[model samples]
Target: MLLAPKLLRSSPSPSALIAMGALVMIELTSACNVVRIGERKISRKLQRKGLDANTALLGEANVHYWDSGDSPETAGAVPVVLVHGFGASAMWQWHEQVGPLAAERRVIVPDLLWFGESWSRKRDFSIDHQVETLVALLDHLGLQRAHFVGISYGGIVVHELAAMHPDRVAKLAIMDSPGRVYTEADHAALLARFEVEDFADVLVPTEPEDIETLMALGYHKPPRAPRWVHRQVLEGMYGEFRDEKAALLARLLEQLDELDERPGKVTQETLLIWGEHDPVFPVEIGERLAAELPEGTRLRVVEGASHAPNLEHGALVAKWLVEFL
Candidate 1:
């Protein structure tokens, strides 16, 4: 069974307004990067939780990850690898769940190639390449199998990984990812909903307004913040590797048909977590995917949630993941 958290207020509180004002003041008066400052704070928290930042060079790609290094408390537990979506790095995306999930079992969170410190010189940005890189990262860590949780685009990657190398994946959790079930009509409708000709404009945000659009689409109750703060996020987080990221999005869409053509269903027992009002990939897609998967597959919809429930309801999502994995 899936548990739901209390719905967060859609409107901003007075305290939130005051904090936003202070952030604007900081942006105007100081040279400190607001996004980086926030990232550093999150990094310190994760460090305190026993996750160490490290890098693994996998031939063509350099993968940067946070590992809850081997310890007696989690010695015999199967490691859980958290794969983040298109927007920010893994740390920024999975910060909330990391501490809780890491407390019981080893958790490995890696920055996907072209995001954070992980990157590849090879021009290939297909999902298959991403799966290969993640497999290489696992091999580098000497982990033969692990439970995988992937959100958004990362979901597509992990789905491909499980399908291509079923032996490498013990259990799978897909959060708001469309996978091969996304059809051409779904792609067209997504563009029409966002009023953009290219989906990359929606995913690979380049402007402050783009970020606003993303938050609006991703969350049921998007947090209120000033435009300058959004600009800071755009510059600090989404600015790097803009072109490559756009290319990656394009390649993903282009390769969908190819992926669908491949044979066989994912044999591993799967869990699907979706936001009730996900505008990007609607909950209907999740229902369709669940029916197509193995007999034991299940879909758990979070009430009053949007595209990224893990961000909006992190604790609940983590609880479900811990129980399922």
Candidate 2:
């Protein structure tokens, strides 16, 4: 049974604003104990595909992850770390890359704090915290350095890590991310385009319509699924980590004003993969992002794809990742 979370922010409508004041009260009483059957099955199937489920205590958070075991062959193979975005766990986000990449390399995929089984009550939800936590996780695994692959929000974290800890990153791959601090105008325009009051409403969807809106914006050719599937996913995959994600985004936005719009100088080798028809970030942003990075940063545009290109064209994305990393 898929039970949906009742806590949802409103669209940019008068009716939505009317109930905004009561959001806190409603969230206090709202419980997110839903277990999505479909996601559960996928998780198990991924485990069988050699992505072993594991957990590690990093600071106050207990991070759940999928690990392709480190072995004699893997010792020489490059370690590739996959970080997920806002909506789902690492398993759902990088399902395609894990199995294929693991065949030749060591892959580590982790659920960021406040997503999946990772949770913490600490109010410090900056992107740097995630970077530090991930660094610590890498340290715990005895990994000195690895190539980093991130998408959307995860890409932002990878960017920060590459900028702050250049020595620790061998290669960086960022997909469909803003890549630089977004200007206030950029933020306002995206909100207007999405027809939503805030990002939390869209990223952590509560209703099937919200999921539909996310899909419509995320893909140039959105996958067709039954209404029940969206509902189950909304209830199961998106129910947990409501307030925490909002706080995390809020903190991330707070840093935006502090950073100049121009991309900071990053020393590591970089690969930027984007969707040609990305409605969320747009292809123009990718062009500008490429110019902002260090010399020789390569940009690859996936034709006929959108924000979530990895999902829309998994085979193409996997090929790019394999070649880049």
Candidate 3:
């Protein structure tokens, strides 16, 4: 069990120690199942709007997702898959755009491994396995090719899919992700920006305060909410599978070194959307990606937005996606 850092203090009263012990017990118990006030509302709203809960029994896991639109094989509409970053789930990340996009295209939003209701019994948490899992899901849905929209970590996975199986992917859009290979220099720069030695220190949060810190880092204007709301969100979204997620993080670090050491030229026409004030991967990264990608790739910047332009500027991002895809 990971211990929260102890505050250095003078000798505490017996009552205070007892209260602390009780709080620890509550936290551990709630880690398994805590009803998040805000998340529940948003989830229900998304479901009411059109997103339906569905499950796919893949090889190693039973993946749960909120899917919209008919399968690609059966429908004539263009297929578009939205892959979310490291956080809660597809429900949380793409809730704003799902309905709007589903109207015109066949939109599929999936929860990545160890996220939402998705989990793997096999110990393989490498990026290659993740790529395989997604491919399997696409196969299950009878999709041979589709446009992909990814945010942050999800962007990396879609970029990999395009590189490894270019014929299987049509168009690609990446937001707030370093699609290219990251180097030792990039690692140092991130650590310096976050004032943390490891990326996990910033990406993974154990406490409510840590979650808020992550939000502050990711968003230019973090939402103001009550303390209890933040705590509930953390316990509900991140408390489960803590160990597995940490293991996955370790595997991802190794894969970044091996799989994306030096990305080859991506031939597919790409649309890169970035927030002007993105604190995580700055606009410069997007500029670099545009230059590195083949000619005809476009970069669209959203002013006043942060890491997640989709959430910050949903209508504009949706317009771009519809036009680009």
Best-to-worst lDDT order: 1, 2, 3
Q: Candidate 1 lDDT, tens digit per residue, 1-325?
A: 0111211244566776666667667665555667878988999989998999999889989899999978899889889999999987999888888888888889999999999988999989999889999999899999999999999999999999989999999999999998789999988898889899998888888789888998998899999888888998998889888998998998998898688788655889899999999999999999988987889899999998999999899889988998897
* Index of the highest-TM-score prediction: 1
Which residue runs does candidate 3 get wrong by more than 4 Å? 1-35, 71-75, 260-265
Most accurate candidate by lDDT = 1
Cα error of candidate 3 at position 137, Å: 0.4
User: Which 10-residue window in model 2 sums to the lowest lDDT?
Assistant: 1-10
Kindly give the number of clashing pairs for every candidate: 0, 0, 0
TM-score of 3: 0.84
User: Which digits, one per residue and each the tens of the lDDT, describe model 3 over residues 1-325?
Assistant: 2222352154656876676677778777666443554467767876765667889999987788777657453368668889998887777788778767777777888898888889888778777777788898889888898888999989988988888878778899989888765666776787898888767766778877888877787677888766776687777788777777787777877776775554554678899999999877889889988887779999999998999888878888988988887
lDDT of each: 0.89, 0.80, 0.79
Model 2 segments more than 4 A misplaced: 1-37, 261-264
